[model samples]
Target: MGSDFYQQSILPFAGIIIKICRAYTHSQEDFEDYYQEVCLQIWRSRDNFNAESKWSTWIYKVALNVCLTHLKQRKKGEQQFVSDALPDEVHDDAKAFGSDELNLLYNAIKHLSEIDRAVILLYLEEKSYAEIGEIIGANTNSIGVRITRIKERLNKFIQAQE
Candidate 1:
């Protein structure tokens, strides 16, 4: 019984939740707190899931909603993390991402307003425009336009870094 649910449910979505939390929250403690909160939310909400969409889609909605609400409370200004002192695991992820691209991504993301980052994060994870809109309470057509500009702006931001 113990291994059954883990094998069926938790294992599949854990990495996605972790990555979403990481992308949304810069502070380590907050990230862990929110990640756990998301897990609890998932467990509680699982029964309500109707499966009209894929399981991944439902999980994304719940997890992203949790992150957005949490991120909305953060301060306005962006906080920069100096690469040198980052812990080995995070440091390795950054390094493996390649300095140039990773720096561009971090700079681009850090520059986004909290909500915009949430939009872009879900979009990047390949959520459909309708799903993105539903998650953020926008129309699908509008979200499609916003995503295009967001990608362009992200590119410009990367260029600014270079």
Candidate 2:
């Protein structure tokens, strides 16, 4: 909850939170909301962490769970809102990466099922199958199989965009 704790502990993993939030939200407002909620949850749940996993892995689990729950809540309400502008953070991310291909890949990723998006994002982050499995509560072998299928779907999606 303290700024020092955030600065030293949570801020280091902000990129992971940003990526998960972006995957779950379509607009900047929603993105900010999701991002804030994730951070808040991390702070609130800080004591719940038992150190059974690395801090980064615990962060991943928290971020993914927060986003997935937020997505489900939004779906239940089902209000449609469109925004013409991208989030500043997203634009900055694209610029930071220096590639439109990353944007294309993100667009394709948005089309995936929520769980698949998490899997691919973790895989893209170069997380080991065991780490991803530990985060998502799935078997490592299934994570591998799911990643293969998710990659195929993402490929189809990107190809269709061409």
Candidate 3:
């Protein structure tokens, strides 16, 4: 990766990448691996971006795809990484409630279907349905419906934990 490219392009969007990595990975090591891979992919695929959307949107689309691909490759029943750190992107109230609650939330999030996980993550980031649809290749209406279902499922999961 060119230094100028890293400085000018990737660095500005690293936080979004890191947050996505944290949401998808189980442990610190996995988070680091995903973060590195996403950054590398961004650099490697930089030329593929056609400037059809905001750079951040393209970065988010790439990051989510990478994480989803990595998750699918892991063997079922294999060990997953877990930690008490607050998930990287969430409301400040989540931070104030403490890491234990956040950990519980993360655990619940992990139980969701992969697409639902993506939907919820984007929702948490406050992306509009149209933006999410563009990133994930779903229609805006489907994204809305999925978000409703994901919220209901997450609520049930959290309540069951209590």
**Candidate-wise lDDT, in order:** 0.69, 0.83, 0.78
Candidate 3 overall lDDT versus native = 0.78
Q: Return whichever of 1 and 2 wins on lDDT.
A: 2
TM-score against native, each model: 0.73, 0.87, 0.80
Candidate structures ordered by lDDT, highest first = 2, 3, 1
Runs in model 2 lying further than 4 Å from the true structure: 78-99
lDDT of 2 by residue, 1-162 (tens): 687888888777878888898888886678777777787899999999999899999999999998898788788995344324443444565345347887788888999998889999999999999999999889998998899999999999898898
Candidate 3 at residue 130, lDDT? 95
How close to the true structure is residue 134 of candidate 1, measured as C-alpha lDDT? 73
- After TM-score superposition, the amount by which residue 92's alpha carbon in candidate 2 deviates from its true location, in angstroms, is 5.2
Tens digits of lDDT, candidate 1, 1-162: 245654577556765676677777766666666666676678778889898877877777788788777666455553222222332334344345346666468558867876677789888788888887777777788887887888899988887777
User: For candidate 3, what is the TM-score?
Assistant: 0.80
Worst 10 residues of 3 by lDDT: 86-95
